[model samples]
Target: MTALAPSPTLSETTRTTPGAGWLLRLHRPALYLWIGAVAVLAVVLLWLGGPLTDSAATAWREYDKSCDTGGSCRYDQDSIVRYKDVYAYTTAALTALPFVVAAWAGAALFGRELEHGTAQLAWTQNLSPTRWLTTKLIVPAVLVTAGTGLLVALHRVMWTAGDGRIDTADAWYANLTLHANGPTTVAFALTGLAGGALAGVLLRRTLPALTLALACVAALRFLADQLMPHLWPAVTQVTSLADGYRGSGLNVDSGLVTATGAHIADPGCGSTIVAGCKTVYADLDATGFYTTYHPESHYWPLQLTTTALVLAVAAALAVTAFVLLKRSTAAPARVRTEAAA
Candidate 1:
């Protein structure tokens, strides 16, 4: 009766438990739903693509009946319009798909937690905060990147084949342009995910989270495509030589690229090669009709490089969100309660 009970052994106290993957397993129900949706979408897309791609081309050839044959052919307006339509639809699908998937993943990431207040117990579990968040974040991220990259590649093929329509005003501009397909889209997708998470965290309300997420996506994308490209250190078209020849130079519209040296305007000489004289040229690039030339015959390098810079901006935003998530001071349940109140 006087003897005291012995304490439990270390092994008994520390019972075997599941690995870190359990954190990820929580999303299994959502994943199953997503898989079913994707399967259905795949079947539908395959059916749609038949008419849009292979069949459209076949139909065009038959309707035209006689293309410039006998080793000579040229694209007519009808051909250009049809071809552009194919590229436009492909581009629109590609551009919209990223937003669709990213938004959904984003919604899932924070929505479920807020909806059920499950993070309270989840954060207190054996898995460290970093591991828990990482597991949760990374799984959806992988799915998003893979799905987005596949669609983007398809867009690239269509765009390249169509030589890419250049109207930024067009809703499908990003799809056609992101064909450079490097760090830029990486940044874009990450930004989208971060935006979703942030929306979920801040709003604490599902409809608001979705609404704000989409609005932010639109606003952010507009800034990226509309504002960032025009920033300083922007790539410019310049002549290689000092005395470079310009065909149909100087669009009076753009006010940019003003004449530098003395204007040698027609001192009574038509088609006469003036030996030691200078002329100025500039253009707005409107309609791509202002025919000024540049040293770089191809702008692929500039396009890709600038695209990378734009993507970097997105990456920076994502990093900011990640840092905020990691260092959030309040305990999960406490923060949620405070947020809700």
Candidate 2:
């Protein structure tokens, strides 16, 4: 007679399995939401790169030929207006994605499990707390990185296509435009994942963890914006009054340079005669002007440097989360050992 095969035990199955099937199942809703968002954003970006760009170019040509010439122009004002609004919103959506990641990670991925004893239950069922947290961090980190990276690429493509054509397009250094259109977006997404996981692990309460994680992500973004200009050294050039201040990229500062090499504010006297400001202009010695700016070449360097800094912060947060998990999981064993002793 053939013996009946024994069923696999829960611990045996868990140990043998390589993926977070249960966790994925638990947050299936979030996954679907992310997919939906990416789809919508992708469609919008393609629109921006194609039809909207052409419409915007046409409107810009019309405006330049007539309105800019101090005459009336029959431009398709609605199309241009729509293009600008949509582009602004698209960039805003990409910029705001990190906060969404933080919220989901804190409330759904970590905090919910900790709050309801789910994570502890998993630990009892042959999964270690470290593995549980690692899975949480790794899975979301990968997803966030992939999603944001794709969006960044799309944003770059759209921006390149619209450059010099769309009159309302933002300068490359505009805070939202810069962050949304480069690798910094991916960096911010990863930072959000790490920060949210840490916050959730520390708070272990869904609502508060969610709120704090979003706040933390916002703070990180703000800090990044504050430090971005300093990431790369700026270039300063003095130009004659005839040339005017026409430097591009990230304009740091522009001021009048006196003949004595001292910097002074522009006297607002550009080819226009101002009687009251004669003495001021003479003392200003505005033979020429200086523009302090990060030229176009500095764009990639600034983006990469900021990305590295943000990644370092993410690494630190990940390490802290691991440490917190270890301490939280080990406390009970330590207490029992002391009681036994």
For lDDT, the strongest prediction is 2
lDDT on C-alpha atoms for all candidate structures: 0.48, 0.83
Where in model 2 is the C-alpha error above 4 Å?
1-18, 66-72, 240-244, 264-273, 284-287, 337-341
Looking at model 1, residue 51 earns an lDDT score of: 39
In model 2, pairs of residues that clash are: none
What digit string (tens of lDDT, one per residue) describes model 2 on residues 265-298?
8867663244554566566666677888898789
lDDT string for model 1 (134-190, tens) is 555667777666666655554445444333222211232343454323334544665
TM-score of the candidate numbered 2? Answer: 0.88
